[model samples]
Target: MARLKKTVAMVGMMGAGKTAVGSAVARALRVPFLDSDEEIVKAANSTIAEIFERDGEPFFRARETEVLGRLLRGTPCVLSTGGGAYLAESNRRLISEAGVAVWLRADIDLLWQRVRHKTTRPLLRTDNPRETLRKIYEARVPLYGLADIVVDSCPDLSVEEMAGRVIEALRQRPDVLEGE
Candidate 1:
């Protein structure tokens, strides 16, 4: 098994396959896998959509920040965050201090294709979801570029292939991953 010296944070726009790829990476590394959105849902006893509808985005974001901070302080693992998590400067700082953030860079069209039919994304519940996703992608790209590593995602790649790409990226940073 590879030795993960720090948490591997998966940060990117929605439909970038953070959770799916992060899970595979954790499996490959023989480490635990954590998801910030899942943690928030567990704590709030509500689905993300429900939370967004009831408590609003600000409330969910606060919970997300708290969950992220707590998780980043824990043992090294693969941590997948919500799409908007890295948009906050404080969350980005926390991740930088405690973990290595990897941006799962996928094209906007690919992201739209992946998430277009998914009703779970509260942010995408717009009249024109494709356009909305494009706007979101445009806004978040710069923020994601600040990550410690970048793993490009292609429509042709399988989940395991994406995970392998992330692992390759992480291996380049010896401080983040060692003792393979």
Candidate 2:
């Protein structure tokens, strides 16, 4: 079968289901799914918390950049990045130039409902996760809006459904998939 020259990317808040959706999309496209955070963990041989504690966020972020670039260099995989990964100017430009960046949008209320009890996420570290999410959401909304595509997604929807939407959107914007 044929494949898209450029891969698809899912970006949004922490609970936006990028990893889940990206995985499904990759399966649907008969491609691979790569979670940048997971790749980082595998490379560093530690959880994100350990990376943050031992190396600091800046160091972890630098590793994140390298990891993102490395992942992009491989086959066109549907990559699910950390909440702040795409926020970096270099990473954003890399995605925009190389792949189809899709933003998954969800309100803070929905985000809180979905992210509750999700301890694996390092960014939500706070006395009040809801407030932290809200603030982060507000700040990142504009940057997320810069994506090539946007989807209204919440935890209520299955990852497959969201991935279907992403595939459809990218299909519509064939220009983004030029090389493949």
Top-lDDT structure, candidate number: 1
RMSD of each: 0.7, 2.0
lDDT of each candidate versus the true structure: 0.94, 0.84
List ranges where model 1 is wrong by over 4 Å: none
- How do the residues 1-180 of candidate 2 rate in per-residue lDDT, one tens digit apiece? 446778677888888888888888888878888999999999999999899988899999999999988887888878999999888999998887777788988888888888888997677888988788888999999999998888888565677777778777777776644323
List where candidate 2 sits over 4 angstroms from the true fold. 154-156, 177-180
Q: Candidate 2, 130: how far from true, in Å?
A: 1.0
Query: What alpha-carbon RMSD in Å does predicted model 1 have with respect to the real structure?
Result: 0.7
Model 1 worst lDDT window (10 residues) = 108-117
Angstrom error at residue 30, model 1:
0.1
What's each prediction's TM-score? 0.98, 0.93
Provide backbone clash counts, one per model. Answer: 0, 1
